[model samples]
Target: MTNLKIALIGNPNVGKTSLFNALTGMNQRVGNYPGITVERKVGNFSLNNQTQATIIDLPGVYSINPTSTDEEVALQVFFDQTNKDYPDVVVVVAEAENLKRNLLLFLQIRDLGFPTLLCINMADQMQKKGISIDIPALEKKLNTKIVLTSTRQQEGIDQLKSEILALVNAPTTSPFDIKTINPEYFSAIEKNFPTIPPFKVWMALTQNFFSTEIPLDKIEHFRQNHSIDVKKIQHKEVVKRYQFINEVLKKTYTLDTTKETDVRMKLDRIFTHKIFGYVQFIIILGVIFGAVFELAKFPMDFIEGSFEDLSNWVLDTFPKGKLTDLIANGVLMGLSGVLMFVPQISILFLLIAILEDSGYMSRMVFLMDKIMRPFGLNGKSVIPLVSGTACAIPAIMAARNIENPKERFITMLITPFTTCSARIPIYIIIISVIIPQTYIAGFIPLQALVMVGMYAVGFVVAMLAGKLLSKLLKYKQESYFIIEMPTYKVPIFKNVLLTVYEKVLSYITNAGKIILALSIILWFLGSHGGENYNNAEEIVTQSEAAQTMDKEELEFAIAKYESENSYIGKIGQAIQPIFAPLGYDWKTSIGILTSFAARETFVGTLSTLYNLGDDFEEQETQIIERMKNEKRPDGTPVFGLATGLSLLMFYAFAMQCTSTIAITKKELNSWKWTAYQMFGMTIFAYIMALLVYQLVK
Candidate 1:
């Protein structure tokens, strides 16, 4: 079988992703490019019985000149011949209505002397918008084959695939001449680098970066020998390319303005309104979050109950031993903590995907820029901040889209302040226990209001942190913001599902690994300890309190006593004093510590600690009920209003999740900044929790 590699390239919002999905359909895998945080998407497909192809979806960019990391990644694949993702053929997807503007990138890629094919996408919209294209004439002018595709309608996809296969064997040639822009400069470049393409050499010189294939010393020598005006040359190059493009487009393309409608403009007017825009965005968020809670409750309960039953079954079916105990009480319990919240996470991703697909997310970014610019962020930062609500790991990675180093760093540092799904379990359990269940004004649930309040607090704190960091961090580059307003359309369900699937799967895999490891380690620590643990039964049985307790109560007391004397118990005891002022007892201290592995593990840790026993009845108990009944040495409740609120405040601001820390280090590529973020957030969290406890208590 013949194997081929294809690079799919396009501008943002050009239906490139939809085409990739339609071509590959569940055969794709997403990861990071070599050493960068920019996402890399690859998929495999079979073109014929004896031929197979691997397609790489390069980061979307406007032109070969790079302004952001995303564009740099895209440029690298084309420039670096030795790159693993370097393609045998390049396919540039272009929007049908915006062919002229899209061709700028297509032309640049074609001029690089690659066998390139232009796939004009969204062809279904051409007639509705009264746009007509002369495909044969355009293809002849551009010196490439053109395939009209509507990924939504599955039109012309087979033709696209066939053209791709044919292009693989086609001869490579440049359609545009670099010497046309500046003959003297190109002649000099060709003289210096005879073996290399002048256009590639020009790109390296103008972009101020070069691939491994180019000799850095030679390029540097040439630059020092010749006085080059990079900006002026870049402007000249753009003008030259567009001059050719406009002439070709005029002969081959036509759009009847009289046949077009102003619906898009009218919709943009309302959606982008200074006053109404913000109001609509807020309402949309409210509905989405409200749906997240309401839609997830039934599935969450089912998952919770199912896990409980499985744990009990493991206890009953397996011989009573350490392994069985670990599986039942440790792994299963911890997995349940995160798995149960999957419904809520999935729902949130589903809604966010729909918003993004429908083009409303861009408007939100545009609207929020006015608010965020006062801080250190731009419209791009809105994406990472909004994404942070789902998971901080990817949220931080999403900050790669922000071109400004200062704003990107600020976005990474402050994004964790937004409430993540990991914190959802923590928030829900705590709110349920402390906040009233009744509704306000006989309509709005007070619990829901508090939940919204928590989200608001995170956003407000993130903004304040951004403002502070903007002043603290020093960078001289001026920030610029430009966003595309994609024509709003019904979200493609396949695309939405794929996005939701990938994100949710990532969330589960990351959280599951940490939770599973910590659960077992926590169970072992809580299961066995020093001499005190071994003598727990004797100590509890002989106590005065045991004298009044029944058999079941006696068993529970002994189990509790043993857990407190266990290794984890001793560790908790050592940390108890530090958190005592914040109203967290030794047991709750254990939960807080385990939560560093994952915030959701707080519930699991408490479950394992409070329910460590051999009694069958005790194994069926719920963590919330046990927590409600818990009391300190003085007979006061451990989870009172003040303590619950304190815990909520701490988790809200604390940098607890290790996954987030690792990704932050990877994205920022600085241990110093990572350490600063970790300790800074943690200390602030402690101070806030302490104050809240003291004031509320």
Candidate 2:
């Protein structure tokens, strides 16, 4: 079968990915570019039995002259001929409402002389907002095929596909004439690179093409070495395109400004209020987190119990062996660990989509900017923080919108500190295990209040970190936060469903792989080792010292010996000395190490290490019993209130998510920052945990 490479490119929030899903269905993978952290989404679909097409969904951008890393990736993928994998055809998805702004990008692609197909998406919104376009005129003027599509309505999708297939077979036609900088300048370039595309020459002259791609030796040796002010030239080009768009719209479209205040604007006025807007935003977010933990409790309980029941059933049915133990104790534990968090994560993202669709998020940035001034964070940085709850990777990506370099960098650094939904399961289990259920103000459970307090600590620490970095970095840029509040329409069900599907799938897929791998590795580490390991050394020694102990006491002592000397026990032993001052035993040490893959794995790791031999719920009960009665070498209880609080504090501040570190490296453009972040966060966590443990103990 012949393979065709096609790219879907457009401005952000243009539903490009949705269209890609509509085309590719479930066969998709979420990956990052080999070197950079930019998301790489590629999928395959059959155009015909004879031809299979591979589709790449490129990052959204405003123009080829890239500013952000994502935009740069898009440009490199499109313009860098050395890549040998450039798309055969570019599908430009443009939002119908923002045609003028969207057209600028489309025109840039067209000028590149590539096989370009224009998709005027969100066509349904156009009619509702009183927008009409002369389709034939647009096609004729742009000299490219146009497909009017409404992804939400599922309109014009088949038409779009047909147009795409036809584009492959249709003979190439040079679209519009390239706009000239000056007649003399163009003529001179035309003479110099006679065989080359005129726009290609212009791109080189303007440095839109990378420095190496331009013939520096040839340029210096010829053409009188005339220097061009390319920045000025590019600005003129933008003006020209806008001028053309203004003219085209005069004939092809009309808008009714008399449409009164849109629901988007009305909602924004309240949600983005200078004072009330921010309070409401905070309260709304508080509700989201609160709801995820409180309201989802029943379902999470059911999932936890179900998994426990399944594990016990397996233990009863299967003959005892290493493989049986691994399956019941490791794989099931890992799967349960990941699956338990799905409900909370899904609800968190659902709230996020609602806020975004209601157009309240953009205004929250504006409202919060004034308040964040005291905390050293740009108000714009809040978006990344808000989104960080879903995943730190995209949250870090969103930080690019902060124009101030120092602010952006600091935001990227601290975003991981925010408790993402991936940590929800870990937090829930640990808090339940540690915190007492007493109420403070007659209603708020002490546990819930502590959860809120942890969030506050994270926010305060992030603010302080941002402020410190802002002062440390000497470079200055005027901080400005301005965003177009998109018109609010009723939240489209399909769009929300698609978003939740993509984000949740990305999380589960990544977490499942890592959790499963780490679980198996941990199981092996905890299962295999030394002759005297998991032996009766402690019990034998105690019995030898005194024959006065009763059999029940001896039996208890033997169980402790077996647990402390188990394969996992020995591994944790070597590291136990490090965290001893923090009131943690060897098992806690193993939990910490295993949790680096994902924080929530801590509870499951402990369950496995203890040989609880039950599912998640049963393990929780066993854990409570074990922790309550566990002893140190001195026979002191392992987890009193002090130790429990210490563990809780440690998780609250620690950088435990490997995916977050991976994203940090990608966003900061170096391992240096990622290293600094991990080290600094770990050290900070250690110090804080030490202080709390020391004071309480």
Candidate 3:
């Protein structure tokens, strides 16, 4: 009859979030808390006509006492009773294949005294592999209800929902009936702090009493009454808990080793070989990047044209004024912001999801460990590099698995150099305008070939940077890459669709909001300025009297003045001398600055600049021609080979995504590192651009 909060909690790679997505559908919102890196995902679904339930998908963690930042966020929800609303029922999702390993967290949740249900996921995989679970027997043993689910097949979903609904009425159960820890120590803790839950006290002890300050009176009582050393006692209790899990699994599960070796081992030998493994890994990654770039072009062109037509139509229907300018320049630009990257981002996520689902990503990590070691990184940092191609933010967060501090810090520092999809829009716009479209080898467009070359440059440079950093930073920690290569299975269509949906929607929700706000603010600045800037028409008329200039010349001069005097223009001018050696004018300088917000803003900024006096479609030819024929103070073309090459270098290496900065801050555990990344990348990009510009010029 009312709403309830249900949480899906589990260790990483157990498909907890997948189950949550299957249940919640499109009713979801993603954002962060005011002061945390943890992504809070809450979605609502109705269990019946009379009752609604909200599901919270917390980040995956091994245990409540966390060593990693993400794990700490998960632990906060579990440990902080002061949280406004704790889950009404905890669904402990565990993989049926790795039941024992997964149950470690499940048992811990049960000890928290929540009304709990054990969800044994991946049931289909178990059946296919000739593994089976006696669900009722296991449920009775743990004293908890069980739901066998295969989220990929949509199996047991209805039954799971019904069980969760029933949990609202079922009494809470202590499934992790602790029998291993010394009873005297547990008794002493409970007796010392009368109000503190016995389980919380035990968790606090296991975590070495981290942040758990008992009242002064309770602390005095405990110290006076007992002679236990807290650290030594806590260490002994943790060992005992794992010892208990090992014993429980011994009786309950059986594995067929001979059958396991049939395919999984045979595959692993080739996939993780000392020499061939790294080679195979590189080939796989190259193919993924190569395929997405080629296959996504047709759809990208279609979307580009569709947005152009849409903007033109809007400009035609609306009368010219401040409002129409805002619609054509601001809103259309914002929608284009959302549309332009759909093809590349969609294909990227599709490929990544398939690899991740098949568990090939893990194998790739293990293989790359040898190479990554010399670069101050281990196998786990490979995900961040791969993900950085789509966006560095998620890639940076994925570095959570890298336990080594020095390696992780370097991984975060260098990930921005791995060309991301945000850079795609910048590459497309510039390559089309500058790189000639004549056939290379009388076949492929030279422009497209150049774009591909630029991407390769970014990848090569990123690896080289990583290797150099590894040598410079003297780390002697013994680090190795251990990975699990799961059995191959057909990628579930629903899971693929859900993953793409979530990633794409996130791009739109987060990046779109930033672009929309910036575009409006930019429009206001370009439209209304003080003194000679206020009236463009009058200023152009006054300038035309001296030379009897043509309409195009008069308009160009007026546009230059308006851009120079606008608020953003002042910023561009202030920074222009820094870029002037690279053959960039104030306008190009502004594009570079705005691009850090997002690389897609390159076209949007350029469009806004020229479209101040006319519609975007109408000015497309003029804008291209202006860039082509326009000259510098030294009378050289503004966009010759020199400036074009320079611009490409800048976009290729720059730290150009705001979302990435936010994520880096979260992952590195400080704004200090985020600042270092931004400043370091900017200076690096500037130097590379300068050298390229001078050589070409």
**Candidate 3 Cα errors over 4 Å, as ranges:** 25-34, 45-51, 132-136, 165-179, 194-197, 206-235, 256-261, 298-304, 373-380, 387-413, 420-484, 528-575, 580-652, 656-680, 687-697
Per-prediction CA RMSD (Å): 4.2, 5.2, 5.5
| lDDT of model 2, residue 486 | 60
TM-scores of all predicted structures: 0.87, 0.79, 0.78
* C-alpha local distance difference test of each model: 0.83, 0.71, 0.72
Candidate order by lDDT, decreasing, is: 1, 3, 2
Per-residue lDDT of candidate 3, residues 71-120 (tens digit): 55556666555554368889988886777777777777777667889898
Cα deviation at 292, candidate 3, in Å, is: 3.7
lDDT of 1 by residue, 1-697 (tens): 9889999999889999899999999999877676555677899999999889999998778888877655676578887778889889999999977888899999888877789999999898888888999899988898899999998899999999899989976866667788999898899988998877787888887675476778889888888998878889899989999999999999999999888888888999999998999899878876876676678878987997898899999999999998999899888977886577678767777887788789888888888888789998998787678767766765675576576667888999999999987798788778877887898899999999999999999999999999999998876655767677888889999999998777667557654565566567767887888887988889889999989999978887877777678887788889999999999988899888878767876876676567544232343336666677789889988899999999999999999986677567766766788899999999999999999999999
**CA error at residue 495 for candidate 3, angstroms:** 2.0
Provide the clash count, candidate 2.
3
- Candidate 1 least-lDDT 10 residues: 612-621
Q: lDDT at 6 for candidate 1?
A: 94
The true-structure Cα RMSD of candidate 2 reads 5.2
Task: Please give the TM-score that candidate 1 achieves against the real structure.
Answer: 0.87
- Worst 10-residue lDDT window for candidate 3 reads 205-214
lDDT, candidate 2, 414-443, per-residue tens: 887776766666666667767767887798
